[model samples]
Target: MSEARLPTLFIPHGGGPCFFMEPPRGMPDPWKSLGDHLRGIGATIGQQPRAVLVVSGHWEESQPTVTAAAAPPLIYDYYGFPPHTYQLRYPAPGAPRLAAEIRLRLDQAGIPSTGDDIRGFDHGVFIPFLLIYPDANIPIVQLSLLASLDPAAHLAVGRALQPLRDEGVLIVGSGLSFHNLRGFFTEDPRIAADAESFDQWLTQAVTDPDPARREAALTAWAMAPGARTSHPREEHLLPLMVAAGAAGEDAGTLTYRDHIFGKAVSSYRFG
Candidate 1:
């Protein structure tokens, strides 16, 4: 454990290898703003964390699971990307001890969890991070989202992991605030409006001064304005729940906001 207490974050890991590969069909670098935002994360945190406990939208299991490999591999979960993206390396070591502690915390909280020695970091973990922590020096361990995708359960998962923050672990939720593939790719004019509508609601909920009210708002997120349109499936947005739960009484602030593929997106920081 280190001396610095790290803030919890909900970051938008851009769509599949978007950071490395060229934008499709001459689209103006869709990831520029997001990539820049990610690059600034290291400095924004003030100090390097001893380890990072990440929750990604791409991985899920019947119960909560944490990566346990001493030297975890990259999963290259995305397909049809440029070959270089597959070869991209982020040789960050695995924090096996941290993984063990995760399971212990979950168990103590009555939330069943296990560890996997085989699974690797998915695109959601390695992609945006390629910029955030370019040195690849800090250890990272991934925790799987519950297969049930129950919001409250995920918040509980975050709460269980919150104690690690005091021990110098940086808790991060890596997923998009707006994740509608159809709306993103299609030529519909309503996409931006719909995304913004939901983005505003999410910002309000995440930044709510009252911790209880914030959690309640997030628990019932699907009812928010354009919530379904912003997230047809809540997997991408669920990571925010984890970050918020870990935050405890810390109020959230919107650290980044932008439009990609004409859809509004956002990121949050909580201390």
Candidate 2:
């Protein structure tokens, strides 16, 4: 008999490579806890995946696209970090065959998509994969977020990629849950309060037993408290829409969640 299909995840990946290198000085308890939870994600999956396809918020394009590189290069996109971070490498092999399969799958699902053989794994893809699949043996590919950043469109992207689950592809959306960088260092009570409120609403919405309500909350997420504050720009949150959309009729489980940087941030998995 075949194994049970695995779930797709949308993880709030904290600041670049910091979680793995070492807890930064003066890092908040919640941020530290969030890092610990990322380590736990691998164990929770119950088994290693044959391959992974991540929809990283960091990579965006005018049209829907997927990365097909057989040997993905490292992208040191962040600045002001330790030199080792720039040298840090996950070295995971890419799955070109899988990339073509993704493009075909999307087309079959009525979603037009292009494939790239030379795309590299950006921080959003590399950092999380380094933690979740540390061995770097699993073949990986990353899909790009469309320029629209529209929740519905992202969900549609997920819907198109849903078949990958049955094929042993672990789909992940790499982004932060509470992603207001400027507000992260602020002492303002209102910012923290609003982030918590919005996170709570998001947690409830994603875990709702009713599919319609879950979809509604995601659709109207821009209205949630601190929505603009937490997101500023919505790319990070957009990946969740794709994860949720791939989840389809099921309201995906919140496999891991925590408030990082003293603000509620979250990660999720959907089957």
lDDT of 1 by residue, 132-176 (tens): 998889999999998898999999999998889989899999999
How much is the lDDT of residue 128 in candidate 1? Answer: 78
Leading candidate by lDDT:
1
Off by over 4 Å in 2: 23-30
CA lDDT of each prediction against the hidden true structure: 0.92, 0.82
TM-scores of the models, in the given order? 0.97, 0.94
Clashing pairs in 1: none
Deviation of model 1 at 48, angstroms:
1.0
Worst 10 residues of 1 by lDDT: 18-27
Superposed model 1: Cα runs more than 4 Å off:
24-27
